[model samples]
Each structure stands twice: as C-alpha cells, then as structure tokens.
Target: MEQQPTADPRGAIETVFRIESPRIIAGVTRIVRDVGIAEELAQDALVAALEQWPRDGVPDNPGAWLMATAKHRAIDLVRRRERYARKLEEVGRDLSLSTPHHVDEPADPDAIDDDLLRLVFTACHPVLSAEARIALTLRLLGGLTTPEIARAYLAPEPTIAQRIVRAKRTLATRGVAFEVPYGPEREARLGSVLEVIYLIFNEGYAATAGDDLLRPALCEDALRLARVLAELMPKESEVHGLVALLELQSSRAAARTGPSGEPVLLKDQNRSRWNRLLIRRGFAALARANAVSTGVPGPYALQAAIAACHAQAYAYEDTDWHQIATLYGLLVTRSPSPVIELNRAVAVSMADGPEPALAIVDTLATEPALRDYHLLPSVRGDLLARLGRTAEARAEFERAALLARNARERALLEERAVGLDRPAAEGPAGTAAVRCGRAGPRSGGQ
Candidate 1:
C-alpha cells in the first residue's frame, strides 16, 4: 500500500464515500439481491478505502476503484455463504468472472441509471410506511448513513436505524423486484418517490431541530436526485415541477441566514444575495413543466409557481398577493391539505386582510395535524400582532417558541414574543410573511 502524503486523507475518504456510496450500493444490490447486504458490502468497501487510501494515496478514479472493490467483496461473501451456487446463477457468470480480475466493469450509462432508478423505486415502495420510505431512500439512494439521516430529520438514531432495517426486510419479504415498475405501477409509485425526495429537501432547507437553519449538503443531494428523475422521465410534468420547485427555493440559500447564522425570514432577506443562476434554472424548469402539462397543474408545479411569485418579487412589497391567493385556491382543489389551507390563509391575509386569514387560522387551531406544529401558532401570532391584539399575539408567539424545535426559529419566536412592548401592527408592511403551518406549498424554502 502506497502511503498518502496528504495531511488529511480521512476528509478525502469521506468525500469519496458520500459521492460514490449510492452507485456502489446500487450496483452491488444487482448481485446480492438484498439492499441491506448490498449496503453492508458498500460500507465494507469504504472501510477498505479508508484503510488503504491513506497508504495508497487515493486512486486516480476513486469511484471506479470503490465499485470494483465492492464487487469483489460481494463475490467473496457469496462464495462463503451456503447458497453460493444459487447466488452465482442469479448474478450470472459475467459478474463472477469479472470479480477475479478486478477489471472494473462499470456498465453503460443507461444500465447504470436503470440500476439507480430501480433502487429509488425499491426504497420508495408503498409497502413501507412514509417515514420508512424516506429513511430507506436517504440511506440507499442518497448515500446517507442511518445516523446522518436521523440527524437531518431530527429523529432518534435508533428509530431511523429500525426504520431502515424494517423497510429492507419488508421489501425482501414482499419479493419486491429490483427493477423500475412499468405502466400504471410506475405512475402509482412515482408520487411516493417524489415525496421522499421532497421531504429530504425540505429538511435541508429548513432544519426541524438543529442549531443551523439550513443543511446545504442535503439540498444538493435532493436537487441532484430531482434532476436525475427529470432526465429519466422527461415526459413527466410533475418531475419537472419538482425540479423547478427545488431550484427556485434553493435560490434563496445565501439570503436565508444572517451573518450570525440567524434565521432570515423571506420578507426580510436581502434580494441581492439570492442566486441568479439558480433562479434562471428554476424558470427554465418551470417552463418545461408547463410545456409538458396537459391539463391542471400538478401539486409540485403549483407550489413552484407560488415560489416563483416570491422569487420574481424584487421587493417583498411588490409581490402579487392576489395572484398568489388565486394560485393557492387552485392548489387547494388539487391537493386539499390543511397545511395548504394555512398557506392559503397567509396569501389571503396578504391579498385581502388579516381578518379573513384569522378566521381561517382559528378554524385550523384545533386541527389534529397542526396541534404540535409550531408554525401554526407562529402564523396565528403574526396575524394577531397585525390585528392590534398585542396580548393575544404575545401569548401565541410564546406558545410558538415553546413548540418550535429548531434553535434559531425558537429564538426568533421568543424575540417576537418579547418585542410586544410596541403598539400592535406598527412594524413595516410584510414584516410577517406567511409561513406555512407545516411543511407544504407556499413555505419559505421548506
């Protein structure tokens, strides 16, 4: 083993691991026929790399190196198992023969993509719970470790680990094929796939419980997956819609946090810091979504349009609230989520007045879904503040701060509650941008 001269080879090892883990896992799963075992082999390769890279100085083509290494491990493991003959027959002779020479038989682009798409569909299989689907997809398709997935979503590590374990067991027990579904089956599973990716991006955009406001790495992972899905299904308007939504929302990454890493509300963020490149990409994606659409806009397309409304507004006051409200109205018909209604209420507040919006929020106050959701009270507090009901607004803000999980958001909510000394509704207009009660359309990058 050649020793690496670099001071920090471990960092390079980690970077390589994150980038190539998904591909390695996908490729190995084809041979192993078990996602869990495939992942173990991939991790084994990473461990080998960590041990050797610092001595061998990272390989010229690290990804290919890792794949070759993982394939060899898979072959060895199967040979040791009692069902070696059955496994060899399943993977066929080509894989077995290539393993001996370490010839690095990286498949063609189309085949590789097919493997990845299969992995995505398998991880997002409807047989798994929604939480399980998200966890498994993040683990298998996003190259995220169980602990990393747990941290990103603010769930307990053991809980996430169990979810991943159970999800893989479920797929195996149900005899879920490691191939993309076709026809109606494909369409049926597509929603869950898109949803898992969306949930990942939302967590990155607005962390649920972390000290930090945003996790850029998670955002990058989600965006990359969305773009891949778009290429894989060019005719799918909703795929394009999802890409558009993520692009538009990500455009504000720079402006979303203050110098001290405090949460910068959309209404208060500096427009100049918004990434123009991402915004343009978002517009192009939205155009593609529209061009491909046959009838009503999909859920993601509608949400993208709403985000576009915010992106195009050079100033918060210039935003077309009425158009947004109309879009929300349309979205409600299509999605009909309480979270959507909360978002619509925000638009209604901006378009009409806080009175009607307050009515809507009051109705949602008792909603089971919104009970532990801090944003519900946060939005209600903002509305109350605007309505000159300082005492009620203060209480709501305090309650919101108590329920909020993220440190930055909790601090912001506490600050708002403490600042109730001023006469109600005396701040600049648009001070309280309508935040969705939960993660849904019209959220500020969430």
Candidate 2:
C-alpha cells in the first residue's frame, strides 16, 4: 500500500512558504551569490515541495527542508551552466569549502542570520531607488506575491512585477555586495533601511491611495521586520524607537475605521477598542530605546515619545498635550522638517488653543512642501471652524478633500466640509479635524 499525504498539504505548503521563504532565499543567496537566482531557486524548491510534500508526509522542520531543497536546486543550476567548473571553484573558495549536500541537519544558525542580514542590506541598498528597495524587500523578505503587493499598494500587477525584476537586475548588474557594512558604511545604509520600514508602516497605518482605510498586513510585516532588526542590532536605539512608534500607533488599528470602512478620527475612536497588549509592548520598546540612547533623542525616539503620550492617556481628554508639544518642539529642532513643524502645530493646538496653532499653520501656508499637503489644510480647517470662521473652514476642508488621494480620506474630508453648512447639532465643528500626513499625491499606496 502507498502512503498518503497530509489532509491539507497544499495549505501547509503555503503556510510554510510564507514563514520560511525569507530564510530559503537568504540561504540560497549565500550559495549562488545572486538575489535573483536565489529567489528562483527558492521558488523551485517550493514547486518541488508542492509536488512531493503531498505524497510524502510534511517534514518535521519544513523550513530546513526548504533550505536544503533550494541548496540542491542551486547546485544543479551551477552544474548545468557552461561555466560550472569556474563557478564551482568560486563557490568552493567563497563558502569555505563546505559544499551543500542532501542532509536533514539544519544549517548553522549564525550563518543563517548572516545570510539574512546580507539579504536585508542588499535589498535596501542605496544603489536602488527608495521605491525599488521597498518593492523588492517586501517581495523577498515579506514573502508577498507580486499580485499581493500590487493589491496592497493599489498598483497595477505588471508594474510591481517589472519593478521587482528591474530591482534584481539592477543589483546584479551593479555587482552589489551580499554582506552587511561596518562603521560609517553601516550607519549610512541604516538610514535607508529605517526609511524603508517606516514607509511600509505608514502605508499600512493609512493607505495612501486606496479605497480601503487601512492594510493591517503591511503594518504587521513592518512591525515584524522592526522586531527582527532590533534583535539583530540591539545596540541601535533608533531601531527600538521605530518599533515603539509603530507599536503605539498600531494599537489604534482596531479603532481607526468604522463599520463602513470610513476614516475614524483619533479623538472620535472608542478608547476601549485599542489593543492593550500592543500598548504595553510599545512602552517596553520606548524604555529600551531610552536606555540605548546617549542623552540626545533620535528622530524615531522623538516620534515614539510623542506616540507614548497618546498611548499613556486613558481618554482623549486625559492626554498630556503640553508634554507632547514639548517633545515635538525638540523634534523640530533636531529634524527640522516642515512635516514635523506641522505636527508640532497640532500638538500646540491641543496644548494651547486654535489661535496659536492657526498662526503657525498660516506661516506654513506658503511653504512649498506643505502647499500640496492635505493635512495642512485639514488642520487649518479645523482651527478655522473652532474660531467661528465657518466659511473659511469650509473652503479649507474642500481644498483638503481635493488634495486627498485615498477615497476613504477624501470622503471624510468632504463629510467634514459639508457638515459645516448644517445646524450646530449636525456639524463636525465641535471636533478637531484628524491631522493625516501619511497620504497625499505620492504614488504606490503612500
């Protein structure tokens, strides 16, 4: 009698792929010295697993099984090439002569981590454009299919496919190294890595140009990467800070949308819906960040401090806006970005009143960067409404609606705009407008 496969081996395969694709790709890249080829070999392993795992029982260590299978595929690929002799010599010397073989033993844990770190640095290399780095990193590390990434970012499927293909080719053509940098080089590359992760988290927290209000999967992916990076580089304070900011912000995910998937302002959200566990994690990460810092806070740490203020408040009214404003002031002095100033203005409004914040918003009205920023007008509109200038507030709200890219956000702005014309009981004037800076004219789901 023949042996039977598991009841849902196909499902099991997909689950394993999502969990272990990064490791497989990382390990194979160490073998083949090419990310594109490594990914191809990893996929081949998946195909083999799909064909064989159902017939044979799933392996106890499926990740290790995938890695071994990818290694074999890589070896076959090398042998099939016309330059097999030269390539084998190169691999023999580069990999310390430990040639791969069909064995059930797991690869060295330290080597796996090294490979993963190399893949991370390679995917986020400054040689590639920021957009390319993000798309490729998500595909390689997030284990997201081309279609899945496209759907998440509201991009056409073919565009994302081309982006990933071009990114890999660019890396190969440029002969980018497959290893982490040290000292100055490491610090420089670190910024790009952090930016990539930040972009991912922001896109998930607030969809840039999608009909959906939020994409929790992207947020989860970014958070997982941040946690991994924090573990990989424990001495890096900004990494922990980024993790803290993400955790604190993500705790509000449950309360960020309504039944119809409409945007829910932070003040209007039900505090009970916030995730307590995430809040606790955010606090721990914030503490770790502070512990690792050298007295001066970094960009991520300052932002995390701002988020912490909100997380610590049990109610909207209980929020310590004064402290938040102080933190944002420090952030402004350090980062000196118009966006930071805009956010600080919001904090000022909460701590002081609409008058002072409105003055600050007016100063930024002519700022080239904030000219198209929807949040600027949104904040201005809220201040105008509070100051009894209903007509001006209506105009600002309409302008914000015109600038908003996300359908949900546009609808929210429109709602706020139209409500001003209604009676006091039906108007949104009592509540401040939600200051949203993450969404705008930028493409690819912001």
Best model per TM-score: 1
Q: Write the per-residue lDDT of candidate 1 for residues 1-446, one digit (tens) a residue.
A: 43345656888777777767777888898887789889999989888878877765776567777787888888788888867788778777345354322344455555566677788888877788888988898777666667667655546889999999999899888978888777778788888889877866776677666577776766776787789889878899999999999999889888888899987776777999999999999999999999999999998998899889988999887888898889889988898767778888888888888889999989998887677667778888888888888799889899988887778888888988887785543322223333332253235322
| Model 1 misplaced stretches (Cα beyond 4 Å) | 1-31, 38-76, 82-116, 126-135, 138-165, 181-184, 422-446
Q: Can you tell me which runs of candidate 2 are displaced by over 4 Å?
A: 1-119, 126-170, 179-185, 423-446
- Report how far off residue 338 is in candidate 2 (Å): 1.3
lDDT of each: 0.77, 0.74
* Model 1: lDDT to the true structure: 0.77
* Per-residue alpha-carbon lDDT of candidate 2 for residues 33-135, written as tens digits (9 for 90 to 100): 7899999998898998888877776876677778877876787788887666776675563232332223456667667666766787888888888768877
How far is 98's C-alpha from truth in model 1 (Å)? 16
Give the C-alpha miss distance for residue 302 in model 1, angstroms: 0.6
